[model samples]
Target: MSSDEIALSPSSLAETLRAGERVRVLDVRNRDESDQWPLGGGDVETTHLPYMKFVQAQAKDEIGDLAAEFDDGERVVVICGRGESSATVAEALREHGLDAVNLEDGMRGWARAYHAEELDADADGATVIQYQRPASGCLAYLVVSGDEAAVIDPLRTFADRYVEDARDRAAELRYALDTHVHADHVSGVREVADRSDAVRVVPEGATDRGLAFDAELVGDSDELTVGDATLEAMHVPGHTTEMTAYRVGKVLIDGDLLFSESVARPDLERGDDGAEEMARQLHRTLHERVLALPDETVVAPGHYGDDADPEEDGTYTATLGELRDRLDALSMEEDAFVDYALSAMPPRPNNFEEIIETNLGRGSVDDDEAFELELGPNNCAATAD
Candidate 1:
């Protein structure tokens, strides 16, 4: 079969999955790698079959195992580390009359296709829209109140979409804020600011990060007001000394300070020297400052890892009571908390340095180059073990 007929673009594949259509995803990675970081989204069914085994069961150099697992003409998307190997596998599967297609650019291509799900509705004063970059679990928020809106921790590749979101909501874009100088995807703060007339806001503590652009700095007690929405900035200096979480009514834009399922790693920006100190700061930030908030307060954090599933209500959120009851990180004593926080972490996200530079306005890349630099899921959390 020709390459054109046997290849599925990531866009088309994402659409199929989002539409709740049945499409079997055959991942040809080694079994261990799949176990370590499984590919999952919503309810999509994925199967792991190492490349060698897949070809070994083929009769007379033709695919038989896949045919046995799936009916003839069943749609399947084959994926490997890079885009190349999957094409070969798709070609092999097609010889057996299955409608197999190679996933374009493989997993990396899939990572760049971000989709948003609105988190707040029908409640009271304001609303929040969550942009979930499913693969990396990097989340951006569109917090709206009356006629004004705030775009926080926007992903670099999807900045314009946020501006469009503001327009769609019939709100004037008032502020573009970053939780901290991100070490994952590029920050779209400048993109949001440049696209509209919004002001840029960063943490007062970001002086250490040496951001190049001018911005209003907010620290604990300093608040940002947009119409009836008053977001109080809380200086929670753990993940980064500069990371800020905004208090909007019951919602805390918790940044990287806390996650609904796990805690942020402390070693990324500090390297090895300041691991202990960073962990201590993180502990205090969670215990002394953040834990003081009301138990009913809802936390909306910056990034999420692979296993987090949004609630059936379509919101990725948790109350202080829920997190306090469920989150293991909250129960640790000072020393254990520090030790756990300083433990081994996953490898940094791809092009993390470049992403920080761009976010700081000290570096630039073309759109294509930016997307290439940010082609995979963000490894922004610590390893479970």
Candidate 2:
């Protein structure tokens, strides 16, 4: 079991995953940990084998069952919560004549491997940068128009990186915006604004949430300038009462109000009783506010999950027409759609209350606490199918 270092960094593993390499990831965390923070995607296959079970098998010296599952020739990688347990498991697996290497830094490392890529905006004068937090299903954007720019739904942890990207694009940071009162991740709008003298704009209804700190509040048809381009605000609720989508040229920077596969759930702030009412509002917002737009308009959502719209660079986006055609569920009758939303509501994201408080500036937590609250892919997309 003793040997020199045998580990794969998250980035190296990500490269292999992206290239469609036939790598098998053996996640050696317990059931609860694996369920809460599952890994392994792209072209990599994952098998859950708890380290404790593997250790017990090693103690018994009857490795037949364990040995039969994995091929000796295939590239097998071991991962734990943070790589400590996986190293031991890898060592044990190696003793059984299997080529297994521990994943360096494990799931924590995976969380930080957010690949920020530029999105090709058919909007003539605008440059949109998509900050894809692959581990958490969070998508933030930096929209640059001429020399001015707007920052949207940014994470608090990556504030500096967003600023640096703005400088790299040579766009003067002018506006910092939050689509709504986020219930998952802390907003970077405050930091982004403080660093660049950018005016922070929250959706008009957000003021009703009793949030203390604020700058500008925007509502329907309210125009905000981004250099040569204009971003008109659309009051699209149902995710939250405050949900607003910004129309930048032909692109709808839709908030949690709409996603690629599913629309936002109605019961987070409302609970079950108010869900019906919220669902009705959602119907109006989509049928009246959002779907009323031209089919050519591009929908850039607040986040994306596994079944998101596919693209060459792993960016999640779709044209209104494409989605309207593909997602037949979106076109359901009003009564059916409301019933569907209420009935199909999934479990809320972990620590949503604390996350919402932090976003509202009513509660405060350090970086580590914030990270813990916002871990795993966002469950905000209602009925992920």
Candidate 3:
């Protein structure tokens, strides 16, 4: 809506990071929103300031505070879930005489362009887990152990490359996708499964994607053994009814529900009433369930966005403690949080209906058709939560 802002391109952010300039990143997304997913990048200096706080404080009022910690003319990058909201804040900061720029493309754009490090599958180097971010914020996991591995949530566009990466790791692609149904991009799960006939496991609750054979419909606490690495599915049904988080060693594959510093959208299933219930469920899971786990767990989320990191043109992985401290909605009173979440709901994915139908065996589209159906920058939510 505002055009007076100077938004930094992903390339510029990368350059700044490489140059080792003194930069401070301001994240404008709410805390609860950031908890489930976070920006991607193995490197980037970031700061978190929810948009409402930025809007209320005004850059002029905050410059003095930052000046106490930073020198004038030092680079400052501002970001939100998407780049739109942060663009407004960046303009305000620039007006206040600071060298601030919005990270163009945001976490979503960066994910498509960067390579992130992976978690160890066994806490031992014997099993290695690697991941790549592509197609906005969708994270593809390559779980390797004993010359065999599998990928999770691989987007259609990266399907071939994902297979190649597995081979490069000297692992046969044996299994994939046993977790949540994606809302933003159509998944390569069914395609990969169909292509290699690898065992693809999904939850029984998935009625949307008409997924085919060698599929195991798992439930809460169900354990999936992948080359000595055990993946335990923890059913966390807030983002979608079928949303499931994977517990692989000390890290959690938090599907859309949790981020490194944010939470994914919870209204993908339609109905404001349903979304309200989901918000409550998410709160319970965050405080009662996830919090109960060991605090040191590394959180690898399903989606990461542009605003997750402003200094780098990419999003990244984060620890559980980082998210619990941010993503504000997760900390609010249940009713109020639900209201906030629903009020900010963005338009659902364009082909969500088709994706659901195809996953549920109700719709039929071939591989090429699926790729066309799946590829795109995610525009569903106005900003990341």
Candidate 4:
């Protein structure tokens, strides 16, 4: 088969997985890399066989034997770090009479496999599109009303996707907003602004974190209009001192302040020295600012955990009342909440410091470098009971 015919694009794989078609994946990346962030999807089974094993088997004239191990009736999709080695392995397996296909661009491509789900909730006459990055479980949003659109918490890797999506809907992209200076991935606020005539907006509290970019700073209770819809900025600092949430109709474009399965980790910005204080602030934000909304307010967080099941409509969202009842930390006292927020924290995101510098406009990386930097799980959430 031709190389093109022997390869499956990440989007195709995503569609297959989303459709719940049974798929078998042969991951050929190193053990550590595979263990750190493995491919995941509904009804997809994965088997890990390091790429070096295939190379050694081929060198020993045992490629046939190696391929025989994966000779099940199902077609296997081979994946590697960048897809090149996996393509070769897939071709070798095909020569051995096995149906094998390489995952185009491999895990990096998988990281870029972004899916957009239309939120089935009221947005004050606006259409809400939730952009889900499965590889990292990062979520961004696009809100369109009348003729204007705004994108929140966009990733630099898919900046153009947001612009194209907005234009496809016959709407002018008016605003590119970020909840705060992101530590997990490079922010696309600048890229979106550069691509369109959109104004860049960041929380005014971010200025305290040495924000050097030129953006319209929004303070507490600040409002911006998209067509006929109003986006009111709520300064709800917790994950970081600059974290903010935007309320549009009944939906809140809440950044790392909350998630479906966990709350935001408070140490990313200030580390251990200030984690306690930040945790307390986060508690206040949850009780006073976030949970203060009506029970039916749709809380759309910026990220979702691996175990977080999406709603029937495929959006990772929960009502304020639901989260208040579901998360134990939300119901805890101030001291208990702080202890829960700081206990059993996961490792910080890969290359977070550098990503933060890039997002802050204090450093720069080429497009390829930026993509490579944020390739792992976004360990942005704290452990929640």
List the global CA lDDT of all models: 0.78, 0.81, 0.64, 0.91
lDDT (tens digit, per residue) of candidate 4 on 1-385: 7777799999998888777688898999999898888887567788888988889989999998877888876899999988999999899999999899999988888998999999999999899999999888899999999989999999999999999999999998999999999999999999999999999999998888888889999989999999999999999998999888999999999999899888999999998999999999999999998888999999999998767878988899999888888888889999999999999998899999999999989998999999999999998999956
lDDT tens per residue, model 1, 1-385: 5877777877777566555566778888887666544555545668887888866765455466557676655688888766677888888877877778998878777776677777653323778888877666788998888889999998768878988988898898899998888887777887788899889999877777877888888878898887687878888888888888888888888888788777777866777798788888888889999899889888888876545656655657778888898877788998998888776677777788888787777888877787777756576665542
| 3 or 4, greater by lDDT | 4
Q: Root-mean-square deviation of each candidate, in angstroms? A: 3.5, 2.2, 9.9, 1.8
Top-scoring candidate (TM-score): 4
Query: Which residue window of length 10 is worst by lDDT in model 2?
Result: 306-315
Q: TM-score for all predictions?
A: 0.86, 0.93, 0.66, 0.95
Per lDDT, the best of the predicted structures is 4
TM-score (C-alpha, index-matched) for candidate 3: 0.66
Enumerate residue pairs that collide in model 2.
Answer: none
Per-model tally of clashing residue pairs: 0, 0, 41, 0
Q: What tens digits encode model 2's per-residue C-alpha lDDT throughout 5-41?
A: 6778877776665565677889889988887767744
Candidate 3 positional error at 262, Å = 2.4
The candidate with the higher TM-score, 1 or 2, is 2
